[model samples]
Structures are given as C-alpha cells and as structure tokens.
Target: MKSAKQRFAGRYRAPGPKRSPLITPEGAAALKAELDDLWRNKRPVITQAVGEAAALGDRSENAEYIYGKKMLREMDSRILYLQRRLDRIKVVEGTPADPNRVYFGAWVTLVDDDDNERCYRIVGADELNPSSGFISIDSPLALALIGKQLDDRVELSDLDKGYEIIAIDYKSAAAE
Candidate 1:
C-alpha cells in the first residue's frame, strides 16, 4: 500500500560522523548572533507573512502561503541546528599551548613541491571558508598539520602531495 516516495523516504542511510566540539571564539560569536537574528527578526516576519497569506484562504493553491510555510520550516530547522550546535561547542580563544606548532586556530603558511605558497587558518567545521583559506580542523590537511612545527614537511594523502610549513601565526579573537 506504500507509495514509491514513501518507501524510498524510509530507506537506510548512514549517518555522518559527529563533528568536533571545538570552535574559535569568533565562530561561536557568529553562530550566536545568527541564532539571535533568526529568533528575534526572521521568525517574527515569517510568522506575520504566513498569517497574512493564510487569511487569503485556499492555502493549497495559494503560492504565497506555500512559499511562506516552506521558508518558515527552513528557518526553524536552521534555528534548531544553531541552538544545538552552539550549546555543544567549546570556544577556543587566546593562543595555542605551543606557540611554535600548528594547532587549532593557527594560521599556517605552506609551500608546495612546485614552490607555490599557500595560507590557511585551521578553524572549526562551522567556520570553514575555503575562499578565505579557512579550513576545518577536521580536514585532512589540518590533521596532517596539527602539532607540526614551522619548516616541517607534511604529506597530504587526500591531495596526493606534500607541503612544508613555512610559517605559523596564532591571532587572537581581537585581532580577527
């Protein structure tokens, strides 16, 4: 009696491994700000829109009502995720225990075999911004670089290449 869509929806799918609970102070602040904005501003506006749209009647055919409901659901999902994530995360501020080695929140400069230089900041999963060279602490490159000192050579199996640590800098939350 089950439809194809209903059967497929219940199919087994492996859950992803849990992310590390470590986060930079800045990342934690950003998440908190986002959560506050969603709860205080976005949810209220969406609720009003949904109410107005529903007043038009025939929600099944009202595009405005449908779109508003969809958006409200998405917003609620994000708010819940943010709330749980923020609650579990531990904000890492100040400098690493070892100033000479690469660790979480370290800005690392690396040189490739071809002599090309690159820079990346090892941050939390919630703050990974590839375009700005911020990589997740759970990333393969960060794993390889963790506890590595400047001038240390790191082999990245994922990239099938090796890079040498050229510089390591730890900027505080204030500097960022």
Candidate 2:
C-alpha cells in the first residue's frame, strides 16, 4: 500500500480560511497566465529532466531525479489549486454605479485627524498588495471606508483612530 504522500503525490494541502471569491480582471488574468505557464512550459521541462535523471541510474540515490520529483509535486499542487480557484471566483470589472461612495475597486484618499493623508485601493483578498496600496475588501480599514462619501468622517474604535474621506475615485491616483 502507498503512503498518503505517495498516493497523493504531495498534492494534499491542509484546508485554509475560505477566501473571498471576488477578483479584479487584472488579478484573474495574472492567475490564469501563471497556471498556463506552469502546466504548459515549466512542468514539461521538469518532467523531461526527471526522466533523463531516472534513465541515468537508480532514482532513489539520484539527487537530480529526487529534486525534480519534489519540484513536480509542488507545482502539481499549485496547478490543482489554481484550477479550482479560477472556477469558483467571480471576476469584478468596471466602475461601480455610485463612484462617489467607496466600493470594490475604488481608490480612496483619507486624511487622519493629525492631517496625514493616505491612499488605498480596495481589492479582493487575492489582490492584496501593500506596496501597491491595494487592500483587501475584507480588511478592517476597507470595511470602514466602504459606502462612505467624500468628506465623511470615519472612526476606527479598535485603533482609536479617526479619518475623513478627502477624495474618492474608481481609478488609482494621488491624493488630492
């Protein structure tokens, strides 16, 4: 009988917190392209390398063969995850009906009580990038910003912070 690892080929991953299924068009495209590249290009090259290593001699002691197999298992797991994620996620596009109020994909500017301004774009969980100022809609800050309009005062009780909406737009831009 094969061990669980051998039977699954290392494809099994422990369940994680359920991520929100909303993704921007660009985020969806990026994920799809990664899936295609792994399945079509990278996997085939690694498979060939493993085959060559296997043909050379005993695979159990062959370092190249072992490494290639390990890489293959990891890539296969990611491929499976991408396939399932793409199928279930909803791709959000276009500006919201009410652009004045913050919504998914909205770039909002807020000034803290100390008069420091910050800008962030509300995106899905898969698209969160702090450096790029893209925050997940599930985040506390984004949650508070949603449904708010320009000049609206927002308060975060947990952090004892308060901010006022300075600007709101569907497109990312510098704070006004």
Candidate 3:
C-alpha cells in the first residue's frame, strides 16, 4: 500500500500547455466567489471535523479522520489553484473596438446550410460552458469565426455543414 504522499504524487502535474489567460468579467467573478466560499465556509468546517476526528486516537483506522483529511487536501489544492489562476488571469470587459467583426466576448449568431441557427459566445478557455453556448476562443469553431465579419461563411473539416455568420453582438450580450 502506498503512503498518501506517494498515492497523490502523480495528481499534481500541471495540465498541458497554458492557453489564453483571458476571462470574462463574469467568469472571474464566479471564480472569485468559489474561492471565497471554499476559503471562508467550507475549509474551516472541514478543518474542524478533521481536528475532532484526529483527537479520537489512531488516525490510520479512523474513517472520519481519513475522509476529512482527504477533503481538506482537495480543498487546499483547489484554493491554491484558484488563487494562482486569479492572479494571472486578465478579466476582459466590454465590447471590442470592432463590433462588426467577431472578437473576444462577441455573441455570434450562425446559420447552418440547413438553416439551423445557433448562438455562441467566444470566451476564454476558463469560461467554457457548452450548454450555455460559451465556447473557448481557441476552439476550432471560434478560431474559424474570429475576425470574420457578419454574413461570412465558416468551413470546418469536422462539420458536415458550413456555418454562416448571421449576427455579431457584444454590447447587449448577457450571461445565461
């Protein structure tokens, strides 16, 4: 059996190459809220539970102690990551200078060859929410649409139908 240090050693590796550090104002706010919640509300409660459990004799066989410790570790890891990321992130607000062409924070309305319409907001990688139609600027779809003006056609190899840019709006776009 591996010690906790050995067991968790491989989990701390940094993810693949860093992408853009851009984040919407809302995304940054959400991340900050999460950090605050974890730091102020959750971590303290877990720390108390772990401390109480540790006072109950042998920790090796104490399930409460072990589980509480694990939760604390995970929370600490998240808090550290959030702090680091928030420090490095750039919060992008307002519409880009060129509203006619697609750019970061633009809500792009598209129509497929079959006339199927879809709206997607080009955002930073940290703000990706497919269900909310938020896509990363680095995504293939956004990559193809970036800098393209309304009425332009976008062709991607993976898609069966070509998408045409129908609308580009930034000022009035709101988070869902």
Candidate 4:
C-alpha cells in the first residue's frame, strides 16, 4: 500500500560502500579507552541520576526523569556502537613494509602546482580530524596517495587539483 513517492525513495536510498576495518594502534587504544570510560564511569552515573529522578515524582510530567532516560539511551547506543566497532577493527601496528611509499599511518607531505605544501596523516575513519591534518584512509585523497612514492604526481579530478608527493614518513609527527 506504499505510495509511488515512498517506493522511489526507498529504492534510491542504497547503502554506502562498507568501510575498511583497519585502524591504527593509537586509534584502537583511544576507542578502547572511550568504551571503558563509558561503561565503567558515565553509564553508572547516568543510571543513578535516572533512578533518583524517577523517585522524585509522577513519571508522566517528570522533566528530569525524561531527560535522564533520553541521555541514558544515547549513552547506551554509543556504547553498543563502540563495542561492535572495536570488535571488528584490526589495529595496524608499526609501519608499512615500504616506508618510502604512502600507506596507512604514514605522514605524507604534498606540494601543489602553486608551491603550497600540505601534510596529512592517513588514519582510520574513526580518527579523522581534518584540522589536525589527519585524513581517513577511505578518503579520496588518501586512496590516491596510497602506494605512491616521492616525486609522484597525484591527480584529483574531483577537486580539480593535483599534488606531488614530497615526502613520506612513518614516524609520528606529533612526537616531533
């Protein structure tokens, strides 16, 4: 009994491609720490708050109780997502076999035609921070950079730009 519009919408909304389950060691550790904090600390605190709010008055009109319940649900949902993500992710340790080429966890330096230099670290999707120069491995730029060596030109047709690989280092740039 669905309308044509509804059927068209459902047919057009295809799922996105599956993301790779590879994660850097640091990224994995961060996720684990967050999951632990949620389960051991935040969850208990919210549960207690919800209990206290429920005891205060009638459930129907209780704003505090409703808010607490909503917060608890959000927290639980995030915890579940983290648990599942952690279970499937494979932590990539050390460096790539070919350190001279761009790969996951590599700090890459690129130069544009205008002589502008940019640096980025290819990392897991969960750890991407554009402002911090961390790019997800699934990103188009990272995909283009992968396996490319020094002095190699990478064409990004979508962005209408190209970059030359200037340097590739596996060491953590943040430490330096």
Candidate 5:
C-alpha cells in the first residue's frame, strides 16, 4: 500500500483560495528558511529517532517507534509540499510599477462600518493564513479590495451576509 504522502503527491494543490503570482520576498524567504531547516535539521533528527526506535523491535507496542514514525512522515510530507510550492512561486521584491493599485504582497488596512479596523497582506495561496494576517488574493475581501484605493468603499453580498470595507491604507514595503 502507498504511504499517505505517496497517495497525496501530485493530487493536492495549496489548500487555500486562489492567489496572484506575486509573493513578498520576505514571505518567500521565510518559507525557504523553514523548508531548509526542516529538511536539513528536523528531518534528519526525526529519521534517526525513528530508526533507533524501530531497532528496538516490538514495533506495535513501542511508543517511540509509533510517535517517531508519525512525526517523520509529517516532516516528509511538509518537505514535499514546500518543494512543490517553491517551484511555482514568484517572489515580489518590491512594489510594482503602478503603486496606486492594490496587488499581491500589498499591505492593506480596512475599516468596517462600525469603525473596526483590520489589516491584511495579500499573499499566495500556499502562504495564506488568516491567523497570521495573510489573506489569499482570491478571497472575497481581497478580490473586493484589489485596485481600490484609500477612502473607497466596497460592498459585497453573499447568500447569508452583506459586508462593506472602506480602504484606509495600502502600501508595499518598497513604498515605506
């Protein structure tokens, strides 16, 4: 039987909304650093641990064997994911020629009708994590904000809810 990683290889794309071709250089570098650390350090350590644990025999009852195997598998899967992502990613080192437009890698601030503020960075699908303040370029909010400027209001309606965003600021690292 194929391992879980084998079964998932080539069958899954980045599990997030669609994204633009551009990604911040910092974001790309961060991803590369993590991938490097995992492959060069963590993977080797986990592999050694698993090997040592398996050598103890009684695999079914061995706690280290079981847990080490699981961790090794997870690390392997993540390495594969990062490699594939790096192959397709395009890094944005600076602001685009047209600074007025909101594009991928842009830091945007929005104000809701109730005066609540939220900041988001438009990022590639692979790097999109709402908890990290990154939003996929294809997300409803990002799509609505793209090309809009400060003071512009955007209204979006879905089956269950209607929302509005007032762009407060949009800037790129190069613009800072």
Candidate 6:
C-alpha cells in the first residue's frame, strides 16, 4: 500500500488525478467565507496570542509560546490549503443541462438490501460531511450513483460493504 507521502507526491504532481470541477457556486462562496473568516478574525486572534506569549519569553520551556506557535503554524497551513483548493475548484450550480442524468450537486437517495434509505448530495472533495448528508463526487458511492436516475437500483458489490441506489433527488440549492 502506498504511504501518505507517496500518495501525496503521486496525486498532487502534474498529470495526476484530474481535479474535479464539482463545487457549486454556493460551495465556492462558502469556502471563500471560511477562508475570509480565518484570515480576518482567527488569524489576528492567534497572531496576537502568539505575540503575547512571546513577550513572556523563555525560549526553552514556555508552554504558551510553544502552543501558540504551533497553533499559528496550523492556522497558516489551513489558510494555504484553502487558498490552493479554491484556485483549482469549479462550481456547478444548477442541474447539468441534462435533467435526466445525475451529476455534481445532485441529491441521491439510496436503499440497501434491507430497504434502509439514505440521502446524500454529491459535492466537492473539500465539502464532504457524511453527518450533514453530503458526499464527495469522487467517492465510491457517488461514482456509483452518478449518471444514474430515480428508480434506478445500483448494486455496489464490494468486499466490505454493499449498497443500492433507489432514488435520486437533485438539490436545487447548491452546497452552502
């Protein structure tokens, strides 16, 4: 199995997995909002804390300095990540011109063999939140459900889990 470093190098380099243009306009706006919040509010708060912590300096054993610096590094990293992701993202707002087929931003309802029902919206990789009923377009379940329609039953025959797609509900409101 490929380690995380190998996977990152292979996947992020040129000619790697084609970046999916899957986010909706709303999703883009949401990402922008989060990035904005981080930069405007959170960054300054953390920066101030780090600066204050540094003033109490003992370079070797100051817990506040260590933790504050760590937090600043983490915040900067996340800000960079969001910026890079937003640059490569593509937003899909309305149902694709084809109303019959499933694509990004479509809400799909699935049923397992026992007739258990589950709903999910196909979204960008960055916005997947299973608890909130959103699934990444690049995920296995989304891959199986895409291009399918209502009343279509797709069998996800895999070793660990098996599921069926019974209904497809398109989300009119884009990802927020």
Q: Whose TM-score is greatest here?
A: 1
**lDDT of candidate 3?**
0.91
Clashes of each: 0, 0, 0, 0, 0, 0
Model 1 lDDT tens row, 1-176: 98897899878687887788999988998999999999999999999999999999999999999999999999999999999998899998889678999989999999999999999999999999999999999988998999999889999777789999999998543389
- The per-prediction CA RMSD against the true structure, in angstroms, equals 2.3, 5.0, 4.0, 2.9, 5.3, 5.5
Q: Which candidate comes out best when scored by lDDT?
A: 1
**What is the RMSD, in Å, between candidate 4 and the native fold over all Cα?**
2.9
What is the descending TM-score order?
1, 4, 3, 2, 6, 5
Candidate 2 clashes between residue pairs 3 or more apart in a chain or in different chains = none
Query: Candidate 5: how many backbone clashes?
Result: 0
lDDT values of the candidates? 0.92, 0.89, 0.91, 0.90, 0.76, 0.78
Q: Estimate each model's TM-score.
A: 0.92, 0.85, 0.88, 0.90, 0.76, 0.80
Candidate 5 residues 1-176, lDDT tens each? 99999999988887764446666677788889999999998988988998999999999999999999899888889999889878888886766667666777777777666677787888776678899788987788878878876567767675343234444334544453
Question: Could you tell me the lDDT of residue 172 within candidate 3?
Answer: 60
Question: Mind giving the per-residue lDDT tens digits that candidate 4 earns over 54-172?
Answer: 99889999998999999999999999999999999998888777888888889999999899999999989999999999999999999999999999999999989999999888877
* Cand. 3 TM to true fold: 0.88
| Global lDDT of model 5 | 0.76
Looking at model 5, report the run of 10 residues with the lowest lDDT sum.
Answer: 159-168
Tell me which residue pairs clash in candidate 4: none
TM-score attained by model 1: 0.92
Q: Give the clashing residue pairs of candidate 5, or none.
A: none
For residues 98-154, could you state the per-residue lDDT of candidate 3 as single tens digits?
Answer: 789999889999999889999999988888999999999889999999899989999
Best-to-worst lDDT order? 1, 3, 4, 2, 6, 5
Greater lDDT among 2 and 3 belongs to: 3
Give candidate 2's error at residue 69 in angstroms: 0.9
Off by over 4 Å in 4: 1-16, 173-176
Measured with C-alpha atoms, the lDDT of residue 19 in candidate 3 is 78
**Residue 93 in candidate 4, Cα distance off native in Å:** 0.6
